[model samples]
Target: MEQLARLEDLPQTYIDHLTQSNLVPLWPSLRNVLPPKQPVPLTKATAWHYRDIKPLLLEAGELTPIEKAERRVLVLANPGHGLENMKATSSIYLGMQLLLPNEWAPSHRHTPNAVRLVVEGKGAFTTVEGQKCIMEHGDLILTPSGLWHEHGHDGDEPVIWLDVLDLPLVYYMEASYVEGGDVQQVQGTDLGHHYAKGVVPTVHFVRQNANFPLLRYAWTDTKNVLDALAADANHQAPAQVSFINPETGQDCQNIIGYSAIRVAPNETVQLTRRSAAQIFHVIEGQLSITVNSDHFDLARSDTACASCFAQIDLINRSEQPAYVFVADEAPLQKKLGLYSTRPRSV
Candidate 1:
């Protein structure tokens, strides 16, 4: 009778404390405090929902506040391991970054795939998979999952780029692993020695020589590919290039996926109908993006998004030429027939 009364009274105290504090109170019988019921662990697996990033729109001929902010490479998200602001499982994780002159971010590596889209400035380089690639303005450099890479600014001006990774999935799986690079940098400053010297030969998966795994994509010849695609009438998608396995011509990674973005001067592109949420970083010039009805101006180092394909529209305002980096999980979402975009009424 005493135990039964205590059980009823103990719950009453817990409930009273919960209502008063608006938080879950611990029971003396438990080893640790219990979290709120809303965040309780699920018995069966549940599908995670997509989240959108609010966009920051920039004006024509205007620079982002980061210029005056006087810092290099602002981190958009780094909320611990499991609590990262962006999801890495169901979709790709994209981050906006700006690096001023003379700044160097140390070398590091992790399990998720990553890429950098140079937004502005020059003289910044990322060494990936042993290859050093000068992250020129408008260049896209990829760091494959489990590759060691680092960023350094040796240029005269600040360099900004978007950091996209498959962080959410790794975080959710709780398989997060990280490590520092083997050295400060390779012996050479150029970003070519890692693979050109035959030290790193292509790995073979089958007799077909298919699916060559590579980690770097330099901008030196990428622009030419964009030009060729622009000249081809059959190719309508902007920057519609896929990261292929160098050996097999297969995708570099599976699941969390890819995007193609190349903006013309003062051009605004409308997406067709996409369902996977995407994060966009303004690579060059200034951009005004309208998702559904709301809009935001984004300059270099600024980010915007269309949550799970909630209707996306983009307009470039810079004069010199503009580029944008878009990250999405279309590879997975499209497989489920959930990736598409409808033009929102202007």
Candidate 2:
């Protein structure tokens, strides 16, 4: 690669004139925008253990009431992007949100799309687009852009869920904002279970008001499918299942992709590099993961981030089957015509 000129090489007088007109030359930073092989990534391989976060999250509960702290959450910010940015990757925003017993998070709609992965506790439910979708352990729920969603807890213990949003990208585009509203009456229950594997209701796949058909994906159903897929493959490397809209058979949401993987006991699987950044949250058993050079021993409820084109290896250390929830930027990348993956045998 040819050496690019540094900004300091430019004459001070020329720099001053360009500064006056708010114009900056790109030659000096050209390589940064267009690297030799792959694009430089600000997302880092990072981990957020639930063990460490639970205490602090509980403290937040004691520190303030739900009214004062709208979404009581501790953002899982990637250091490479600066912690203040509250981004897990360039387009993904992650946070550990807490909803104490009897507490309610008011109804509000935002321009950015979001999803909630149930981490701990239950009896918490999210009412999205007038449907009350119950939040259970390992369940996946979506709050699509421009949809009113609110959370409430009816369980005796506190409930915590991992919040993943396309906030960074939306905020960057200057289209991020929220509008509050009164509680919505439950128009219907979770419609996810209404449609089974390879089956869609002819009566009405979804209610008329629902633009994004399915809202809640039960872990039970997902686990059953994962186990079936793995067993059918005779406990092959690793089994994966994606969450998608039952109607269109596309990703559950357009901005981000959600999936779950089941790694057989004591089995190891290597996932080839991809252009999209990825996140892993262990839902069951323990996981030993290697992203590039960084390695993480993830226990249940532990979350980790990996940069773009990151070589990933997942090893189930426990005797029991290990299940992990995965989120990635593939959908958005594919939409932008930048999605790429290179497979490598282990």
Candidate 3:
């Protein structure tokens, strides 16, 4: 009788109602699921040394061909997150791909926007929708969502580049799709030949398709732009330039943001914390980036990543100017009304 009375005292009506409706009340789990504040940031400040990864990349190249491997890429997986997911940060995916001379990475297109920042070698080209854009060290190339593209290397040395993609966003939205193209390599005539002849083959493609107006942001032009910006005597901490869509004059991709930041010799730039995560690749000289309270010194060809909502500061300790290629998830965050930044105290 005592046990029966205890059981009767329990909220049997509420339990029966919840089970019939297939709904679980939040009262018990609310504290665990919805906290007063963000439990913790999803990413960590991490850096990768090219010297350490180069040999491993080379070994991967020897072990598998481009076709077998699909793409010879070594992902810069974040320690905070595990490698099984292949993410550099919670919002961005970063990888280093190597293409040997005379090799080809087959044609395929996906719904996620991607950008490549060339790190080493030259004479490689990525053909997007029949327009070939030559790849050189320090160049930034774009392959927007659903754009057919293929990569091939004709240079004497192996060409390597950092591949940044909005894969996490696509995955989160469940909009990821990949379709392979029929052609393996761009046919007989190298489009690069036309480029060498001072002809822009992309003009016709750009006119035909308004979606992909730009394919390649050449390093020479980018350097010139940076130089022009730096020429101003009152130029500020980090001289920066963004890659924009030729048609919209907006970010290169609708979902991703790309920029080049130049830090003059012996200069330190204190950057505010933002709600979007960013991955940066060091192009030249030496740089020390302080994220939150942690510091990372990046050398030439090194890469570093910062988590969302963390204050960052960049310092150039070398005699020569330092350049960094940055890719971030700001565009999507801004579009969704989730973008924010707080100024850091000097």
**Model 3 per-residue lDDT at 197:** 19
**Tens-digit lDDT track for model 1 on 1-346?**
1222333566676778777987753444333234432212111111111112222212211354433532233335423214335543244565556665665666778887777777667888877655567887667677766667777778887565667777666777787788875545464443333343225444442221123244455554555666577668898756556655444455556655554566767777777655566666554466778766677776655665555535667777666555555566776656677556555554
What's the CA RMSD of model 3 in angstroms?
6.0
How many clashes (backbone N, Cα, C below 3 Å) per candidate? 31, 0, 0
Model 3 C-alpha lDDT per residue in residues 200-241, reported as the tens digit of each score:
455454343575556777777777778777888887746898
Q: What is the TM-score of each candidate against the true structure?
A: 0.61, 0.97, 0.86
Mind giving the per-residue lDDT tens digits that candidate 2 earns over 162-281? Answer: 999999999999999999999889888988767887888785444755457788899998999998998794655569988987877889888899999999998998887999899999
Per-residue lDDT value at 156 in model 3: 85
Indicate which candidate wins on lDDT: 2
Instruction: Answer with 2 or 3, whichever has the higher TM-score.
Output: 2
Residue-level lDDT for 308 in candidate 3: 78
